[model samples]
Target: MPMPKTIGHQIHFAKTLSGLIRRGWWEIPEIMASSCMAAIGIVLGIVGVYNYEKRNGDNKEYKSVYMIMRPDDPRVCLLNNPVYTQYKRF
Candidate 1:
């Protein structure tokens, strides 16, 4: 057995929620678009941090090849090799 006040509160909450949905405040497409935008924002933030560290050469595990500006450069071939090597200053 539920109290009358509790029932009233539940009804009020449901009505409020339904009103919000009816008013297009909680639409499916809007939710999906917002979710996608949030996901993209998160990914962009992660990529920005990665780029920042890459630019600063903070990740010692991955050697930064500064001289190899071109993608087709012979030096870029080193990136494909499985063996990890120490950073060499040219």
Candidate 2:
């Protein structure tokens, strides 16, 4: 008889965990990359949440969403300048 899906998954997970515990899993590139990517993703998610809160707080006008692209900005000026647009170097 076949094992139930949940039970099978649990058994597989336990086996994998046990194997990792026995033989330091950090030496494995796959595990290192997975852990690094997960950590980066979590940090980025936190920064995103902080940005959202700051952008949409009670003082919305004080921190306008377009604050990054102020008209006086050099980058914005370059974008608007016809000469810059005509010969845009990749």
Predictions in order: lDDT: 0.61, 0.58
Q: What's the residue-level lDDT of 73 in candidate 2?
A: 70
Task: Please provide TM-scores, in order, for all candidate models, with all chains considered together.
Answer: 0.33, 0.35
Mark the 10 consecutive residues where model 2 has the least summed lDDT. 6-15
Whose lDDT is greatest here? 1
Off by over 4 Å in 2: 1-26, 57-90
What tens digits encode model 2's per-residue C-alpha lDDT throughout 1-90? 997566332322245766765444534767767877999999999999898877654333233354456767765643343334354375
For candidate 1, give the lDDT: 0.61
What local lDDT does model 2 show for residue 46? 97
Q: Which stretches of model 1 miss by more than 4 angstroms?
A: 1-27, 57-90
- Per-candidate RMSD, Å: 11.0, 13.5
Q: How do the residues 1-90 of candidate 1 rate in per-residue lDDT, one tens digit apiece? A: 986564332322245756756545444668867877999999999999998877654434455663434867755544534466666697
Number of backbone clashes in candidate 1: 0
